[model samples]
Target chain A: MELLLVRHALALPPEGEGEEADHLRPLAPRGVRRFRKVVRGLRGLGVKLDLIVTSPKRRALETAEILADLLEGESWVSSHLAAPPSEALLAELPKEGRLAVVGHEPYLSELLVWLLLGDFLGQSALGSLEDRFPLKKGGVAWLEGEPRPGGMVLRAFFPPKVFRI
Target chain B: MRDARAWVEHLRAHLPVALSGKDPEGVHQVRVAGRRLRVYLDLLGWRVLRDDLRRLVQGAGRVRDLEVVLAGPWALPQGFRRFLEGELHLAREALSPLLASPWTAALLGALEVLPPLEEGQALRALGRLEAKAKRRWKALSLNPSPEALHAYRRALRRVRYAKEFLGLPSRREKILQEALGNLQDLEVLLGLLEAFLSQGADREVLALKEALLVEREKNMAEALERLGLA
Candidate 1:
């Protein structure tokens, strides 16, 4: 199984003075354009997603929706992805085939590094990972193999800037 | 900052050069590139793509090791030279399937689909990598244990790869990794010698064992000094 961890594309800043403002903010116009190319790149790589899961945040939901439309599939929104990614999300992941996850940063980066370091569950066994492989807006990391700690390996990675479109 | 695509392209362009080189240096390049490629693929969970490359590396690695011993003070012992040369031929034969696999074309096509990285994203990745290296080195420096040294070598290799990828300054790391690598080879050779000697001792075998011990000590000392633990 391969996990395609994607960060949401660019989005407008929070307009209000409440936490909910951030939740409601949508993808910027340019983000939509750029992520369109990202979708092409995914298709170019012959990726056919078996499942698409996204955070509840507006930007992430939009990103997930875009990917779903491109793949002609449906997406599931989960609050589990809204905050920092945890091992709990592991259960949310599909048991077979390719899976794409669209979420926010710091969390996505943390999750990527932790998973690569063999501590996907953030268990104490692997101790703490001091480094992070940050994902920029619209970034994606590909990991093939099991989702268990140390079970996966990163195959390909791209941040938003990597898009030529 | 370099994007992952640029790095992948570099690897793709060099694969042919690395594969076709028959000299010691060329074979070594193939071995190194094969190892790096395998590691990168493994990290990304691309296990299927790695099998042929793994075989290529193992084959090249066996030849490289024998070449190293042949280049040493073995002084052209005709029997040993013939023995190693025959082994090198066998090792090279193991690589034919991989060479004929159209691997480069397939790999390049796969890599083209990778997402681009942000400006300075490479820098950030290297920064985090540097920090990880420092943390590991600090821990190993304090411990001075066998397991710690092994762990440190692993981190050093990571730092070395990141440095190579980003074109960062890595003279210290390069030297340290090289020395540590030699130390490992010597350790393995010594173990083999010990096992052979345990079976039965010849004057030539005993002399080679002594030479390997001296080389191992020298390599270990050099590695430790470079690591700042000596």
Candidate 2:
């Protein structure tokens, strides 16, 4: 099974903003353009997603909804991907399916490290676009095998900078 | 001694007592008793009987948790109160299918069996319990690694429960209790150490780490002494 971990696109700051920013913030203009580019790149690469799962958080849900629209599949909202993925969260993953998890950072990074390595250690660079897989906002990492807390192979990593073309 | 009909009758008699009460502590006790009985049957080498018993016990645990929720603020632990309040909202949203599950019927059926425990039987139930205890102790001593500690604890608990079930004399109960307590202390310390390691070596986290490690060593020494292995 394949698991795709996508960090949600850029979000407006939590406070001092319009109602949309308060709850279910729509993607920023730049975020939309970057997401489109990344989606096109994945399509061009012939990537197929069987399931799309996202955090209940508005930004993540919006991102996953967009991706589900683009990828043509149903998207599920999961509390498991909302925060630092715990053992309980890991235990809930479907045993046999390709899944896409669109969620927030720190947790995403922690999860990526937990998946790529057996333990929650190691840092993936997230800032620069050309560098080895860093988990930046709007970044997506394609992994293969069961969507477990551990034992995931890093198949590909795409950052927003990569979609600048 | 191996009559399936007699065994089923015995099981049915005890089921009701396990299910009649609605109190949180009472429900917990009944569920535990059912689990112990289930484990006893499992150790008797009855897989099919054991599976049925396990399903019943698991259902009781679920119902017990729900009861605690329904009882409101007093039923849960202080630390878990806030969390349970939120969970109760979710529980309300998903109560129907949960109450209607096959497991629920099995639990109610098991509870209906309780009143029969007062009756006397000719079968050598105590002897069966003795045999189960011997087997469990042997299993407990087989693996000593930290990873196997949980299994060891379970085995020890089985032995204790079997003794209680048979009303047997227990010379080792006190030692077993002490050993289990120390083991729990050690496990807590191990958890602290793991968390500290994950947080890295910052001054505050490190001080807490040192304190935990010291406590762990002290507890380990105490446990070894209690077991006569120091």
Candidate 3:
């Protein structure tokens, strides 16, 4: 199975007072423009996605939509992606074909580290994994192998700037 | 707390739509934004802005309550419907000036610079809010009176909003809020019917009142069941 992890595009800072408002915040216009080019650049590189799963938050959904539109893949929203990644998140994903999961910060980087090194000691160290394996907004990381922790090999990683055509 | 200015801007963005009264959702959104602002301000100990935001929510709330009642499933009599429409109109009219007034403008301006609160401070405030909500929940009996239920509902709303600030899910809190909110709506309807009866009671209105009474009873039973009351 091939896995692609994506951080959502740049989103407007939340305008409303609560977390609910944060969920509703949309991607910035610049984010949409740049991410479109990024998606197209990935498509040009022959990246093929069969399915895309995303956090239900607006920015993640928007990012997945852009990918699905340009990449010609199906997209689905899952509440599971909005929180800290767990075994359930991995279990919920299919073990076949190329798939992309779009979500937010530290969680995405943390998930990457977890997949490469199961129960990694650095995972508990504050900012250690993130500093080493930063996933900037709209960045994509590709991994190939089993879906379980420590079972996948990092094939390639593309920061948003690298993908901008 | 860095988002306080954004929150104020959001409320400001909704004000014109609310004043236009073209969309019922405008008022509803304004009320929601106002309530959220008040909650955040309360956490920051911005009492003046919090109090002003309360007034804003209360103003929007008047229109929102009538809209909800009018949109209910019950087929109200033409006369009663017209009466409710008049009330809604007055509420909207009253809301316009309040939203447009210089004091409100000043309040919005003052709100733009709400001091940022540290994450630790916010979490501590949320803890206090949760404790208050827990106490209110504990005070309620399995079969609580209408007033007790109402108080508990308010407490739950505060906790729910506070949790939202920290990006926590509140599905159970939301469910309870919905159940209690329905009961409260029915209670308000019953009160309005009584007031209408005092003015003049026709057979149609009287019949409607009896039907509503039965519905309220049924809802009350369900709400109690939800609270695990016998």
Q: Interface RMSD for every prediction, one decimal?
A: 15.4, 19.2, 18.3
**Candidate 2 CAPRI level:** incorrect
Minimum summed lDDT over a 10-residue window in model 3 chain B is located at: B42-51
Clashing pairs in 3: none
lDDT at residue B176 of model 2 (Cα atoms):
67
Instruction: Give the fraction of reference interface contacts each candidate recovers.
Output: 0.00, 0.00, 0.00
For model 2, residues A1-165, the per-residue Cα lDDT tens digits are: 777889988775665576433444556767877787777777777776666766656666556645664454444445566567778667656766677888777777777767766544333332222233458888888787766656788898887678767
- Across residues B1-230, which tens digit of lDDT does each residue of candidate 3 receive? 24566667788888888889888888998898888777786576433344457778899998988888899877888888887898889999899998887546645644554445667878788888888877776777744677777888888887787777767887888889987898888777777677667888778888998998888778877877897773
Give me the candidate number with maximum DockQ: 1
TM-score, one value per model: 0.48, 0.39, 0.55
Each candidate's chain B TM-score? 0.68, 0.49, 0.90
Candidate 1 lDDT, B113-205, residue by residue in tens: 333334365556656667777887888788765456767776777667766655667787777777677666665455545655576555777
After TM-score superposition, what is the CA distance of residue B34 in candidate 1 from its true location, in Å? Answer: 4.0
Cα-based lDDT at residue A149, candidate 1:
58
Candidate 1 TM-score to native: 0.48
Ranking by TM-score: 3, 1, 2
Predictions: Cα RMSD each:
16.6, 21.7, 20.8
Put down candidate 2 lDDT per residue, B113-153, tens digits, no spaces: 22222213312444455465556545544644343444445
